[model samples]
Target: MGMGTTTIESAEVKAAVASLREKAPFVYGLTNYVAANLSANVLLALGAGPAIGSAPGWTGAFPAGAGAVWINGAALMSSVTPEALDEAAATAHRAGTPWVLDPVAIGAGAAEYDAILGALLKHKPSIIRGNASEIAALAGGAGGSGVDSTLDSSEVIDIIKGLATRLDAVVAVSGEVDYLCDSAGRATAVRGGDARMPQVTGTGCSLGALSAAFCAVVDPFTAAAAAHAAFAAAGERAGRRASGTGSFAVAFVDELSDL
Candidate 1:
Protein backbone atom coordinates (compact mmCIF):
# COMPACT_ATOMS: atom_id res chain seq x y z
CA MET A 1 0.00 0.00 0.00
CA GLY A 2 2.92 2.33 0.42
CA MET A 3 4.04 4.61 -2.38
CA GLY A 4 6.60 3.18 -4.84
CA THR A 5 5.92 -0.30 -3.58
CA THR A 6 2.63 -1.14 -5.26
CA THR A 7 2.72 -2.68 -8.71
CA ILE A 8 0.90 -0.91 -11.52
CA GLU A 9 -2.35 -2.50 -12.63
CA SER A 10 -4.87 -1.82 -15.39
CA ALA A 11 -7.62 -1.75 -12.79
CA GLU A 12 -5.73 0.88 -10.80
CA VAL A 13 -5.18 2.99 -13.92
CA LYS A 14 -8.88 2.88 -14.74
CA ALA A 15 -9.74 3.61 -11.13
CA ALA A 16 -7.51 6.65 -11.12
CA VAL A 17 -9.23 7.98 -14.23
CA ALA A 18 -12.66 7.39 -12.69
CA SER A 19 -11.59 9.05 -9.46
CA LEU A 20 -10.53 12.23 -11.29
CA ARG A 21 -14.00 12.65 -12.67
CA GLU A 22 -15.47 12.37 -9.17
CA LYS A 23 -12.85 14.32 -7.23
CA ALA A 24 -12.38 17.10 -9.82
CA PRO A 25 -8.95 17.89 -8.44
CA PHE A 26 -7.81 21.48 -8.84
CA VAL A 27 -4.59 21.74 -10.89
CA TYR A 28 -2.46 24.87 -10.91
CA GLY A 29 -0.06 25.33 -13.80
CA LEU A 30 3.01 27.42 -14.42
CA THR A 31 3.15 26.44 -18.07
CA ASN A 32 4.14 27.55 -21.55
CA TYR A 33 2.43 30.63 -23.09
CA VAL A 34 1.62 28.82 -26.33
CA ALA A 35 -0.04 25.85 -24.61
CA ALA A 36 -1.66 27.59 -21.64
CA ASN A 37 -5.17 27.88 -23.07
CA LEU A 38 -5.21 24.34 -24.45
CA SER A 39 -3.84 22.95 -21.20
CA ALA A 40 -6.61 24.65 -19.24
CA ASN A 41 -9.25 23.45 -21.67
CA VAL A 42 -8.10 19.82 -21.52
CA LEU A 43 -8.11 19.85 -17.75
CA LEU A 44 -11.55 21.38 -17.76
CA ALA A 45 -12.79 18.68 -20.12
CA LEU A 46 -11.43 16.04 -17.79
CA GLY A 47 -13.40 17.57 -14.92
CA ALA A 48 -10.40 19.14 -13.19
CA GLY A 49 -10.12 22.70 -11.95
CA PRO A 50 -7.47 24.55 -13.97
CA ALA A 51 -5.71 27.80 -12.97
CA ILE A 52 -2.52 29.50 -14.11
CA GLY A 53 -0.34 30.97 -11.37
CA SER A 54 2.03 33.90 -11.85
CA ALA A 55 4.45 36.12 -9.93
CA PRO A 56 3.74 38.52 -7.00
CA GLY A 57 0.31 37.07 -6.27
CA TRP A 58 1.48 33.44 -6.27
CA THR A 59 4.93 34.23 -4.88
CA GLY A 60 4.27 34.23 -1.12
CA ALA A 61 1.16 32.11 -1.36
CA PHE A 62 0.27 28.90 -3.11
CA PRO A 63 -3.35 28.66 -4.29
CA ALA A 64 -5.94 28.37 -1.55
CA GLY A 65 -6.51 24.64 -2.15
CA ALA A 66 -4.77 23.38 -5.26
CA GLY A 67 -4.87 19.60 -5.38
CA ALA A 68 -1.76 19.52 -7.58
CA VAL A 69 0.72 21.72 -9.41
CA TRP A 70 2.17 21.44 -12.93
CA ILE A 71 5.46 23.20 -13.74
CA ASN A 72 5.90 23.35 -17.50
CA GLY A 73 9.39 24.29 -18.61
CA ALA A 74 8.12 25.97 -21.74
CA ALA A 75 8.09 29.65 -22.60
CA LEU A 76 9.94 30.03 -19.33
CA MET A 77 8.66 32.82 -17.13
CA SER A 78 5.49 33.29 -19.07
CA SER A 79 3.77 34.35 -15.86
CA VAL A 80 6.55 33.32 -13.48
CA THR A 81 10.16 34.26 -13.26
CA PRO A 82 12.89 31.70 -12.57
CA GLU A 83 12.86 32.78 -8.93
CA ALA A 84 9.13 32.26 -8.82
CA LEU A 85 9.51 28.83 -10.37
CA ASP A 86 11.93 27.94 -7.61
CA GLU A 87 9.57 29.24 -4.96
CA ALA A 88 6.60 27.32 -6.31
CA ALA A 89 8.57 24.12 -6.52
CA ALA A 90 9.81 24.56 -2.97
CA THR A 91 6.29 25.27 -1.80
CA ALA A 92 4.90 22.15 -3.45
CA HIS A 93 7.79 20.07 -2.19
CA ARG A 94 7.24 21.27 1.35
CA ALA A 95 3.48 20.69 1.30
CA GLY A 96 3.81 17.18 -0.14
CA THR A 97 1.56 18.34 -2.96
CA PRO A 98 1.80 16.33 -6.16
CA TRP A 99 3.21 18.15 -9.19
CA VAL A 100 4.22 17.23 -12.73
CA LEU A 101 7.34 18.66 -14.34
CA ASP A 102 7.10 18.89 -18.11
CA PRO A 103 10.59 19.82 -19.16
CA VAL A 104 9.54 21.32 -22.45
CA ALA A 105 12.39 22.33 -24.75
CA ILE A 106 14.98 22.30 -21.99
CA GLY A 107 17.43 21.05 -24.58
CA ALA A 108 19.84 23.49 -26.26
CA GLY A 109 18.57 26.43 -24.27
CA ALA A 110 20.72 28.92 -22.46
CA ALA A 111 22.38 28.09 -19.17
CA GLU A 112 19.59 29.92 -17.33
CA TYR A 113 16.97 27.26 -18.09
CA ASP A 114 19.45 24.57 -17.14
CA ALA A 115 19.88 26.25 -13.77
CA ILE A 116 16.16 26.75 -13.25
CA LEU A 117 15.40 23.12 -14.10
CA GLY A 118 18.28 22.01 -11.92
CA ALA A 119 16.82 23.94 -9.00
CA LEU A 120 13.38 22.39 -9.41
CA LEU A 121 14.97 18.94 -9.61
CA LYS A 122 15.89 19.43 -5.98
CA HIS A 123 12.21 19.26 -5.17
CA LYS A 124 11.07 15.90 -6.49
CA PRO A 125 8.02 15.95 -8.75
CA SER A 126 5.47 13.16 -8.78
CA ILE A 127 5.90 12.66 -12.52
CA ILE A 128 8.12 14.11 -15.27
CA ARG A 129 7.01 13.85 -18.89
CA GLY A 130 9.01 14.79 -21.96
CA ASN A 131 9.89 13.86 -25.49
CA ALA A 132 13.01 11.74 -25.95
CA SER A 133 15.18 14.73 -26.75
CA GLU A 134 14.01 16.79 -23.82
CA ILE A 135 14.50 14.04 -21.25
CA ALA A 136 17.81 13.02 -22.78
CA ALA A 137 19.10 16.55 -22.60
CA LEU A 138 17.88 16.97 -19.04
CA ALA A 139 19.79 13.84 -18.12
CA GLY A 140 22.97 15.33 -19.62
CA GLY A 141 22.80 13.18 -22.74
CA ALA A 142 23.05 14.39 -26.32
CA GLY A 143 19.74 15.83 -27.51
CA GLY A 144 18.29 18.09 -30.14
CA SER A 145 17.89 21.82 -29.95
CA GLY A 146 14.52 23.15 -28.84
CA VAL A 147 11.45 20.89 -29.01
CA ASP A 148 12.66 18.69 -31.80
CA SER A 149 13.57 15.05 -31.14
CA THR A 150 16.64 13.56 -32.79
CA LEU A 151 16.17 10.33 -30.87
CA ASP A 152 13.24 7.98 -30.92
CA SER A 153 11.53 6.95 -27.69
CA SER A 154 13.25 3.58 -27.76
CA GLU A 155 16.60 5.12 -28.47
CA VAL A 156 16.53 6.91 -25.15
CA ILE A 157 15.37 4.07 -22.95
CA ASP A 158 18.60 4.00 -21.01
CA ILE A 159 18.52 7.75 -20.53
CA ILE A 160 14.95 7.58 -19.31
CA LYS A 161 15.79 4.75 -16.94
CA GLY A 162 18.72 6.66 -15.54
CA LEU A 163 16.78 9.90 -15.23
CA ALA A 164 13.88 8.19 -13.49
CA THR A 165 16.36 6.70 -11.05
CA ARG A 166 18.13 9.98 -10.46
CA LEU A 167 14.93 12.00 -9.97
CA ASP A 168 13.17 9.35 -7.89
CA ALA A 169 10.07 10.01 -9.93
CA VAL A 170 7.95 8.40 -12.58
CA VAL A 171 9.14 9.29 -16.10
CA ALA A 172 6.84 9.15 -19.08
CA VAL A 173 8.53 8.95 -22.51
CA SER A 174 6.21 10.21 -25.27
CA GLY A 175 6.33 9.00 -28.86
CA GLU A 176 4.17 6.87 -31.17
CA VAL A 177 4.13 4.57 -28.14
CA ASP A 178 4.45 5.86 -24.60
CA TYR A 179 6.67 4.27 -21.99
CA LEU A 180 5.86 4.96 -18.35
CA CYS A 181 9.10 4.29 -16.51
CA ASP A 182 9.17 4.22 -12.73
CA SER A 183 12.13 4.92 -10.48
CA ALA A 184 12.56 1.21 -10.04
CA GLY A 185 13.06 0.87 -13.81
CA ARG A 186 9.62 -0.63 -14.33
CA ALA A 187 8.27 0.24 -17.76
CA THR A 188 4.74 0.06 -19.11
CA ALA A 189 3.77 0.62 -22.70
CA VAL A 190 0.71 2.85 -23.14
CA ARG A 191 -0.47 2.61 -26.71
CA GLY A 192 -3.65 4.29 -27.89
CA GLY A 193 -3.08 7.69 -29.46
CA ASP A 194 -3.43 8.23 -33.17
CA ALA A 195 -0.97 9.97 -35.48
CA ARG A 196 -3.37 12.87 -35.59
CA MET A 197 -2.81 13.40 -31.88
CA PRO A 198 0.60 14.89 -32.58
CA GLN A 199 -0.81 17.12 -35.32
CA VAL A 200 -2.51 19.18 -32.63
CA THR A 201 -0.41 21.46 -30.50
CA GLY A 202 -0.48 21.30 -26.70
CA THR A 203 -1.38 17.61 -26.72
CA GLY A 204 1.85 16.86 -24.92
CA CYS A 205 1.47 19.85 -22.65
CA SER A 206 -2.10 18.89 -21.83
CA LEU A 207 -0.91 15.37 -21.07
CA GLY A 208 1.39 16.78 -18.39
CA ALA A 209 -1.50 18.78 -16.90
CA LEU A 210 -3.69 15.71 -16.98
CA SER A 211 -0.95 13.71 -15.25
CA ALA A 212 -0.90 16.29 -12.50
CA ALA A 213 -4.66 15.96 -12.14
CA PHE A 214 -4.37 12.18 -11.80
CA CYS A 215 -1.41 12.51 -9.41
CA ALA A 216 -3.76 14.13 -6.89
CA VAL A 217 -5.39 10.78 -6.13
CA VAL A 218 -3.10 7.98 -7.30
CA ASP A 219 0.48 6.81 -7.19
CA PRO A 220 2.83 8.27 -9.77
CA PHE A 221 2.84 5.28 -12.08
CA THR A 222 -0.91 4.96 -12.20
CA ALA A 223 -1.30 8.69 -12.49
CA ALA A 224 0.95 8.80 -15.54
CA ALA A 225 -0.80 5.81 -17.08
CA ALA A 226 -4.15 7.39 -16.45
CA ALA A 227 -3.03 10.46 -18.31
CA HIS A 228 -1.75 8.34 -21.18
CA ALA A 229 -5.03 6.46 -21.20
CA ALA A 230 -7.27 9.50 -21.26
CA PHE A 231 -5.33 11.44 -23.84
CA ALA A 232 -4.59 8.52 -26.11
CA ALA A 233 -8.16 7.26 -25.92
CA ALA A 234 -9.57 10.66 -26.74
CA GLY A 235 -7.04 11.15 -29.50
CA GLU A 236 -7.84 7.82 -31.10
CA ARG A 237 -11.55 8.59 -31.06
CA ALA A 238 -11.05 12.12 -32.32
CA GLY A 239 -8.96 10.87 -35.22
CA ARG A 240 -11.93 8.84 -36.41
CA ARG A 241 -14.06 11.88 -37.23
CA ALA A 242 -11.44 14.55 -37.80
CA SER A 243 -10.30 15.15 -41.39
CA GLY A 244 -7.54 17.68 -40.77
CA THR A 245 -5.41 19.18 -38.06
CA GLY A 246 -7.94 21.98 -37.44
CA SER A 247 -10.89 19.61 -37.04
CA PHE A 248 -8.87 17.22 -34.86
CA ALA A 249 -7.85 20.10 -32.62
CA VAL A 250 -11.45 21.00 -31.82
CA ALA A 251 -12.69 17.43 -31.82
CA PHE A 252 -9.83 16.34 -29.57
CA VAL A 253 -11.13 18.55 -26.78
CA ASP A 254 -14.66 17.37 -27.39
CA GLU A 255 -13.59 13.75 -27.31
CA LEU A 256 -11.71 14.41 -24.10
CA SER A 257 -14.86 15.86 -22.58
CA ASP A 258 -16.88 12.89 -23.67
CA LEU A 259 -14.25 10.42 -22.52
Candidate 2:
Protein backbone atom coordinates (compact mmCIF):
# COMPACT_ATOMS: atom_id res chain seq x y z
CA MET A 1 0.00 0.00 0.00
CA GLY A 2 1.17 3.54 -0.80
CA MET A 3 1.97 5.91 2.03
CA GLY A 4 0.34 9.25 1.12
CA THR A 5 -1.41 8.79 -2.21
CA THR A 6 -5.08 8.22 -1.35
CA THR A 7 -7.76 9.59 1.00
CA ILE A 8 -10.62 7.93 2.93
CA GLU A 9 -14.25 8.96 2.56
CA SER A 10 -15.11 9.86 6.14
CA ALA A 11 -18.82 10.67 5.78
CA GLU A 12 -19.64 7.27 4.30
CA VAL A 13 -17.45 5.65 6.92
CA LYS A 14 -19.23 7.28 9.88
CA ALA A 15 -22.58 6.19 8.53
CA ALA A 16 -21.36 2.61 8.35
CA VAL A 17 -20.00 2.71 11.87
CA ALA A 18 -23.32 4.05 13.18
CA SER A 19 -25.16 1.15 11.56
CA LEU A 20 -22.84 -1.38 13.27
CA ARG A 21 -23.62 -0.04 16.77
CA GLU A 22 -27.34 -0.58 16.17
CA LYS A 23 -27.05 -4.17 14.92
CA ALA A 24 -24.29 -5.44 17.24
CA PRO A 25 -24.37 -9.04 15.97
CA PHE A 26 -22.30 -11.82 17.48
CA VAL A 27 -19.22 -12.25 15.29
CA TYR A 28 -17.71 -15.70 14.75
CA GLY A 29 -13.97 -15.71 14.03
CA LEU A 30 -12.63 -18.97 12.53
CA THR A 31 -9.05 -17.96 12.09
CA ASN A 32 -6.13 -19.72 13.85
CA TYR A 33 -3.30 -18.09 15.78
CA VAL A 34 -3.26 -15.67 18.70
CA ALA A 35 -2.66 -13.07 16.00
CA ALA A 36 -6.16 -13.91 14.87
CA ASN A 37 -7.15 -13.22 18.47
CA LEU A 38 -6.00 -9.65 17.91
CA SER A 39 -8.67 -9.42 15.24
CA ALA A 40 -11.22 -10.75 17.72
CA ASN A 41 -10.04 -8.08 20.12
CA VAL A 42 -10.42 -5.41 17.48
CA LEU A 43 -14.02 -6.50 16.97
CA LEU A 44 -14.74 -6.28 20.68
CA ALA A 45 -13.08 -2.89 20.82
CA LEU A 46 -15.37 -1.74 18.05
CA GLY A 47 -18.45 -3.00 19.97
CA ALA A 48 -19.14 -6.49 18.64
CA GLY A 49 -19.12 -9.66 20.69
CA PRO A 50 -16.74 -12.28 19.19
CA ALA A 51 -17.06 -16.06 19.25
CA ILE A 52 -14.10 -18.27 18.35
CA GLY A 53 -15.15 -21.64 17.01
CA SER A 54 -13.02 -23.03 14.18
CA ALA A 55 -13.25 -26.68 15.15
CA PRO A 56 -15.77 -28.80 13.28
CA GLY A 57 -17.16 -30.44 16.38
CA TRP A 58 -17.68 -27.11 18.13
CA THR A 59 -18.78 -25.34 14.95
CA GLY A 60 -22.31 -26.68 15.39
CA ALA A 61 -22.55 -24.51 18.47
CA PHE A 62 -21.21 -21.44 16.68
CA PRO A 63 -23.51 -18.69 17.89
CA ALA A 64 -26.52 -18.76 15.60
CA GLY A 65 -27.11 -15.12 16.35
CA ALA A 66 -23.76 -14.15 14.91
CA GLY A 67 -23.98 -11.04 12.80
CA ALA A 68 -21.13 -12.19 10.57
CA VAL A 69 -18.50 -14.94 10.32
CA TRP A 70 -14.76 -14.56 9.58
CA ILE A 71 -12.45 -17.37 8.47
CA ASN A 72 -8.77 -16.58 8.30
CA GLY A 73 -6.53 -19.02 6.38
CA ALA A 74 -3.47 -17.97 8.36
CA ALA A 75 -2.83 -21.05 10.49
CA LEU A 76 -5.74 -23.05 9.12
CA MET A 77 -3.69 -24.86 6.46
CA SER A 78 -1.20 -25.84 9.11
CA SER A 79 -3.50 -27.13 11.81
CA VAL A 80 -7.13 -27.38 10.72
CA THR A 81 -8.23 -30.16 8.41
CA PRO A 82 -9.97 -29.19 5.18
CA GLU A 83 -12.94 -31.49 5.91
CA ALA A 84 -13.46 -29.80 9.24
CA LEU A 85 -13.42 -26.35 7.67
CA ASP A 86 -15.78 -27.45 4.94
CA GLU A 87 -18.22 -28.62 7.55
CA ALA A 88 -17.81 -25.38 9.50
CA ALA A 89 -18.47 -23.33 6.39
CA ALA A 90 -21.53 -25.38 5.64
CA THR A 91 -22.83 -24.81 9.14
CA ALA A 92 -22.38 -21.07 8.80
CA HIS A 93 -24.11 -21.05 5.44
CA ARG A 94 -27.03 -23.11 6.69
CA ALA A 95 -27.52 -20.56 9.46
CA GLY A 96 -27.84 -17.80 6.82
CA THR A 97 -25.04 -15.77 8.30
CA PRO A 98 -22.85 -13.69 5.99
CA TRP A 99 -19.32 -15.06 6.14
CA VAL A 100 -16.00 -13.38 5.29
CA LEU A 101 -12.98 -15.27 3.88
CA ASP A 102 -9.39 -14.24 4.45
CA PRO A 103 -7.10 -16.03 1.98
CA VAL A 104 -3.85 -15.52 3.75
CA ALA A 105 -0.59 -16.59 2.05
CA ILE A 106 -2.26 -17.32 -1.23
CA GLY A 107 0.84 -16.18 -3.02
CA ALA A 108 3.11 -18.88 -1.63
CA GLY A 109 1.79 -22.43 -1.36
CA ALA A 110 -0.51 -23.74 -4.08
CA ALA A 111 -1.59 -26.99 -2.37
CA GLU A 112 -2.35 -25.42 0.98
CA TYR A 113 -4.08 -22.43 -0.61
CA ASP A 114 -6.24 -24.60 -2.84
CA ALA A 115 -7.32 -26.89 -0.02
CA ILE A 116 -8.27 -24.16 2.44
CA LEU A 117 -9.80 -21.88 -0.18
CA GLY A 118 -11.89 -24.73 -1.55
CA ALA A 119 -13.39 -25.43 1.86
CA LEU A 120 -14.07 -21.74 2.39
CA LEU A 121 -15.95 -21.47 -0.90
CA LYS A 122 -18.10 -24.45 0.01
CA HIS A 123 -19.72 -22.12 2.54
CA LYS A 124 -20.36 -19.49 -0.15
CA PRO A 125 -18.77 -16.55 1.63
CA SER A 126 -20.67 -13.30 1.44
CA ILE A 127 -17.49 -11.27 1.55
CA ILE A 128 -13.82 -11.98 0.84
CA ARG A 129 -10.96 -9.88 2.25
CA GLY A 130 -7.24 -10.15 1.56
CA ASN A 131 -4.04 -8.38 0.61
CA ALA A 132 -3.40 -7.65 -3.07
CA SER A 133 -1.46 -10.85 -3.63
CA GLU A 134 -3.96 -13.07 -1.84
CA ILE A 135 -6.83 -11.50 -3.74
CA ALA A 136 -4.93 -11.64 -7.02
CA ALA A 137 -3.99 -15.24 -6.53
CA LEU A 138 -7.53 -16.14 -5.57
CA ALA A 139 -8.66 -14.33 -8.71
CA GLY A 140 -6.11 -16.30 -10.77
CA GLY A 141 -3.86 -13.33 -11.29
CA ALA A 142 -0.07 -13.58 -11.43
CA GLY A 143 1.30 -15.47 -8.48
CA GLY A 144 2.41 -13.27 -5.57
CA SER A 145 5.42 -13.18 -3.25
CA GLY A 146 4.66 -15.25 -0.19
CA VAL A 147 1.45 -13.65 1.09
CA ASP A 148 2.26 -10.11 0.06
CA SER A 149 0.70 -8.86 -3.17
CA THR A 150 3.42 -7.08 -5.12
CA LEU A 151 1.23 -6.05 -8.03
CA ASP A 152 0.37 -2.39 -8.08
CA SER A 153 -3.31 -1.46 -7.85
CA SER A 154 -3.56 -0.65 -11.53
CA GLU A 155 -2.15 -4.00 -12.54
CA VAL A 156 -4.59 -5.99 -10.39
CA ILE A 157 -7.83 -4.06 -10.96
CA ASP A 158 -8.96 -6.24 -13.82
CA ILE A 159 -7.93 -9.39 -11.97
CA ILE A 160 -9.87 -8.41 -8.87
CA LYS A 161 -12.97 -7.45 -10.86
CA GLY A 162 -12.88 -10.74 -12.70
CA LEU A 163 -12.57 -12.73 -9.51
CA ALA A 164 -15.32 -10.78 -7.79
CA THR A 165 -17.63 -11.63 -10.65
CA ARG A 166 -16.69 -15.28 -10.59
CA LEU A 167 -17.17 -15.65 -6.85
CA ASP A 168 -20.33 -13.53 -6.68
CA ALA A 169 -18.94 -12.00 -3.54
CA VAL A 170 -17.66 -8.60 -2.52
CA VAL A 171 -13.89 -8.56 -2.90
CA ALA A 172 -11.78 -6.13 -0.87
CA VAL A 173 -8.14 -5.90 -2.02
CA SER A 174 -5.99 -4.21 0.62
CA GLY A 175 -2.94 -2.17 -0.39
CA GLU A 176 -1.94 1.44 -1.06
CA VAL A 177 -5.37 1.92 -2.59
CA ASP A 178 -7.85 -0.57 -1.17
CA TYR A 179 -10.34 -1.81 -3.75
CA LEU A 180 -13.82 -3.21 -3.05
CA CYS A 181 -16.00 -4.66 -5.79
CA ASP A 182 -18.77 -7.12 -6.51
CA SER A 183 -20.05 -9.01 -9.58
CA ALA A 184 -21.91 -5.96 -10.90
CA GLY A 185 -18.52 -4.60 -12.00
CA ARG A 186 -18.79 -1.72 -9.54
CA ALA A 187 -15.59 -1.09 -7.56
CA THR A 188 -14.63 1.61 -5.05
CA ALA A 189 -11.18 2.61 -3.93
CA VAL A 190 -10.42 3.60 -0.33
CA ARG A 191 -7.29 5.68 0.18
CA GLY A 192 -5.25 6.79 3.20
CA GLY A 193 -3.35 4.56 5.65
CA ASP A 194 0.03 4.92 7.28
CA ALA A 195 2.94 3.30 5.47
CA ARG A 196 4.00 2.13 8.88
CA MET A 197 1.02 -0.19 8.87
CA PRO A 198 2.84 -3.07 7.16
CA GLN A 199 5.42 -2.90 9.91
CA VAL A 200 2.81 -4.33 12.22
CA THR A 201 1.89 -8.03 12.03
CA GLY A 202 -1.80 -8.46 12.81
CA THR A 203 -3.29 -5.27 11.31
CA GLY A 204 -4.42 -7.05 8.15
CA CYS A 205 -6.08 -9.81 10.17
CA SER A 206 -7.76 -7.20 12.32
CA LEU A 207 -9.18 -5.47 9.27
CA GLY A 208 -10.73 -8.78 8.15
CA ALA A 209 -12.49 -9.08 11.52
CA LEU A 210 -13.68 -5.48 11.35
CA SER A 211 -15.09 -6.22 7.92
CA ALA A 212 -17.03 -9.10 9.46
CA ALA A 213 -18.41 -6.76 12.09
CA PHE A 214 -19.58 -4.34 9.44
CA CYS A 215 -21.07 -7.12 7.32
CA ALA A 216 -23.16 -8.11 10.34
CA VAL A 217 -25.41 -5.09 9.76
CA VAL A 218 -24.77 -3.22 6.51
CA ASP A 219 -24.60 -4.01 2.82
CA PRO A 220 -21.32 -5.30 1.46
CA PHE A 221 -20.41 -1.85 0.20
CA THR A 222 -21.00 -0.19 3.54
CA ALA A 223 -19.21 -2.96 5.41
CA ALA A 224 -16.18 -2.69 3.16
CA ALA A 225 -16.10 1.06 3.60
CA ALA A 226 -16.39 0.84 7.37
CA ALA A 227 -13.47 -1.54 7.53
CA HIS A 228 -11.40 0.81 5.38
CA ALA A 229 -12.34 3.67 7.66
CA ALA A 230 -11.41 1.80 10.82
CA PHE A 231 -8.00 0.80 9.45
CA ALA A 232 -7.16 4.21 8.00
CA ALA A 233 -8.18 5.99 11.21
CA ALA A 234 -6.21 3.51 13.26
CA GLY A 235 -3.19 3.93 11.00
CA GLU A 236 -3.40 7.70 11.20
CA ARG A 237 -3.52 7.56 14.97
CA ALA A 238 -0.64 5.12 15.12
CA GLY A 239 1.47 7.20 12.76
CA ARG A 240 1.02 10.37 14.76
CA ARG A 241 1.78 8.83 18.16
CA ALA A 242 3.69 5.58 18.02
CA SER A 243 7.45 5.11 17.70
CA GLY A 244 7.49 1.58 16.25
CA THR A 245 5.52 -1.58 15.55
CA GLY A 246 4.81 -2.48 19.20
CA SER A 247 3.54 0.95 20.11
CA PHE A 248 1.73 1.18 16.78
CA ALA A 249 -0.25 -1.96 17.60
CA VAL A 250 -1.09 -0.60 21.05
CA ALA A 251 -2.04 2.81 19.68
CA PHE A 252 -4.11 1.24 16.91
CA VAL A 253 -6.16 -0.63 19.51
CA ASP A 254 -6.59 2.58 21.50
CA GLU A 255 -7.83 4.36 18.39
CA LEU A 256 -10.36 1.59 17.70
CA SER A 257 -11.69 1.98 21.26
CA ASP A 258 -12.14 5.69 20.65
CA LEU A 259 -13.98 4.97 17.42
**C-alpha lDDT values of all predictions:** 0.80, 0.75
- Of the candidates shown, which would achieve the greatest lDDT relative to the real structure? 1
- Candidate 1 regions off by >4 Å? 1-9, 77-79
lDDT of 2: 0.75
- The TM-score leader among the candidates is 1
Q: Write the per-residue lDDT of candidate 1 for residues 163-200, one digit (tens) a residue.
A: 88888999988887777788876777777778877667
Model 2, position 241: C-alpha lDDT score: 93
Query: What's the TM-score of every candidate structure?
Result: 0.92, 0.90
Question: Per the 3 Å backbone cut-off, how many clashing residue pairs does candidate 1 have?
Answer: 0
lDDT of 2 by residue, 105-129 (tens): 7757677666667557767787888
